[model samples]
Target: MTEQNVRRRGGGKRKRQRGRGEQAMVPDAEFTSYYGRPVVKASPWQADIPAYLFLGGLAGGSSLLAAGADLAGLPRQRRSARLVASGAIAGSLFALIHDLGRPARFHHMLRVAKVTSPMSVGTWILSAYGPFNALATGGELLGLMPDPVRRSRPGRMLGVAGRPGGIVAALIAPAVASYTAVLLTDTATPSWHAAKRELPFVFVGSAAAASGGMGLVAGPLDESGPARNMAVGGAVLELGASRIMQHSMGIAAEPLRQGTAGTLHTAATALTATGALGAVAVRRSRIASALSGLALTAGSACTRFAMFHAGQASAHDPRYTVVPQRERRDRESSPT
Candidate 1:
């Protein structure tokens, strides 16, 4: 697997020259496969894959929002963000488990932590994330709301518990938000592997936009200043990054701009742009803010699905892998 000798070079077979003189420099590594098929297998993940990524990112954003609100003494924003984070993260866990074919297999993965595996590391991060979210959100809930048991010690403790609990969740939020991009890039999928440098930023931006949208939709206008700012900033970030790749990857970026993936991405970009603008214009109106937020949330979800399908599309086409390598090799061999 380490070496792929040339099949034919002009009229003669190639030789591997090593450490003797100025070695041949290639822009991209070369490889071959049976019958022009992919050298590596495509992922067997179902529809749940993108769904899981979407929720994982939403949870991460909410966790950060919660912690920031707490630190700034914005209790309402803090409480709501934490609660949303807990529920979203819990949902993400369900989706991840379902993808494993057998749900209990997830526990087996947890028995031994391996840093080498992104999946394992993500699980560990979630283990910490879930409990912190629970403590932060649940604690605040019982304290603030009318509970069946009046004057309970647990209820009394919950109010104060949210502060530190939220901090812990915040610490791991960005990792939870961005690691899925790394997981995808680590695979053999050409679209994913090629866009590794930009995908994480795209993902984080989506996450932030989504989290901010949820806050704006659910929380009061007076308390959601951070949410509004985040929504606009994140939409801009995601759109700009995706747009840059049009020229960056050349032919390889076509999968992101054509077929079903292209349609979905286009819709996402338009909706996010509209939402970003509307968020500023209608900042004072709760109804308008809610509408903008809803649009943003839908757009972010579509973006996740688009990226997921794009990777699958790239893997199915052989030219994506072969042609890029050939072009890179040719370019490298040419004079400066």
Candidate 2:
């Protein structure tokens, strides 16, 4: 055969093969079977995690606030601070125990401390702080250590011992506020993992604001001033951090901005703002302080719920996983 004829035949055969392949290929829409499914399972973390987080933050922050008030020579503030601190500590312990799959195994968490694990660090912090806070508050409540200067050496020693623990707890409070975010961000939850930076700040601010609000409601006006300021500052930081979290993240931010999360976030924002404003006006009227404090507490709770919902939403959605994985694949395949 001639070269031209041979070329023609080969081209025709190639075209025919291409057509057959096209006809054999099935469209993705035609197959409605469950072929491609998500690989990772959604975390079954219950409400207890966030509740424990909030209580832990509150306990840590309140302890610091109480210590600060004590140092300031505000007896009423100190008493209120100690009471709140003790309550928060107890509540946190309860929540932590409740959340554990094996509540009895919780003691094993303190067998040894690991700096690499937030949970381990948290366990140690609680172990050390919980008992000390309980003892200090108990002493004050029972009037066993009253007038330490005039009391026996043991009473004076107890007061001295309490100071160091209080100081230690105060130092650890910021970490308690922020580390919960780290714990969540380190997880597979898309919304939380994507918000690694802002989440810590948000939690910290929320903790501070919540604790301060509690103190303001419980303490006298003069002593509550610093707590009020802390609350205001925390609210401002939280609002800003939340805005940044929503803006910086793309689709991942949807959980926080829409549906149930949106409602909670909105309520949190409004309550926090109202509480901050009320804090300023609280100096004029005790009633305003009480009302604002309540608002802030409610706001803090809403914020925690919103954060938890956002994480769950992110985990439940397939787009969050698929989009990131697809982008990563595309980047890897691209030429340098």
Candidate 3:
């Protein structure tokens, strides 16, 4: 029977309306199933993953900055960088472990590494990076001990022992900062997977902003010129990348503007902008530096959350998946 006739003749249930034919296919509208059931499984990630992303970026960038500071003979900045790197990694590890639900099982994550697995590779990176950051921070901490204690043999040894580890970590830090985008892109979520090309840039910028902000607060204001510059540059870069992603995604970007994801995105943008402005406008004021640094740190965290939540929202919306695939298939099968 014709769809119209079926609709007019009888209802499927005693009291409910009968189903109707789908709307005509059009450039502006796409069809979805009842209740808009998700087209793919939701990500297994939780709060931990977003937190991990933020902390990892901060740690990675700080490690690089620390290495640079070491070479430049900026002892104070170097020490602060190492401490920030160590603390961020420690928090990242905790969040990761929390996400896993079973801390012991984390060992299995690195049983063997494969090129196909980003998580496994990341596990190895963390395993190597963690020790370096810890040792470097430990060395710095040892130097902070009282004069008598610092002169002790153990203290003297501790002060120099982490230099090599610090160097190695710096070399690996960029990958640690940027690989997170790859991990997100490798997933099936339409929003994240589709924006793979730009996500890495966005993440790298965020890392620089976060790490730079830390440097601003952790070290003397007089020596924070580099930190200020990095913060402003990174924030602008991230903001641009984020806008590019939104435009490139077309209709799929809806999730980024809806519900919880929308709130996070708005917050990230505002904080990043204000923080960046403050960093530049009040360069010599320690109070302004501290506030700007805090703002950027918060903004960086929000960036992770917004992206993750948007990915989930996109996955949860069947139209995002179905429409994009349909368009791709139609284009591929069309006559040349």
The TM-scores of all predictions, comma-separated, are 0.86, 0.84, 0.88
Ranking by lDDT: 3, 1, 2
* Total clashes in model 3, counting residue pairs 3 or more apart in sequence or in different chains: 0
lDDT of 1 by residue, 77-174 (tens): 87788878888888888989999978788888889998988888888888878887887887777766776532577676766776788888899899
Ordered by TM-score, highest first, the candidates read: 3, 1, 2
Worst 10 residues of 1 by lDDT: 1-10
| Residue range with the least summed lDDT across 10 consecutive positions in model 2 | 24-33
Question: What is the clash count for each candidate, in the order shown?
Answer: 0, 0, 0
Evaluated at residue 265, the lDDT of candidate 2 is 88
For each candidate in the order shown, give its overall lDDT on alpha carbons: 0.83, 0.77, 0.86
Q: Which candidate is the best by lDDT?
A: 3
Clashes of 1: 0
Tell me the spans in candidate 3 whose CA falls farther than 4 Å from its real position.
Answer: 1-36, 147-149
Write the residue-wise lDDT of candidate 2 on 1-336 in tens digits. 554564443422222264556222222322111344444456677888878888877877788887887788777776787788888777777877887868777898878889999788878767777777775675466463347443777666666666666666777677766777888888888888888878888888888888888988898876777788878888888888988988876678888878998899899999998998888765767878878887887788788889889888877677776676777799999999
Candidate 1 local accuracy as lDDT?
A: 0.83
TM for candidate 1 is 0.86
Distance (Å) between predicted and true CA of 148, model 2?
Answer: 12
Winner by TM-score between candidate 3 and candidate 2 = 3
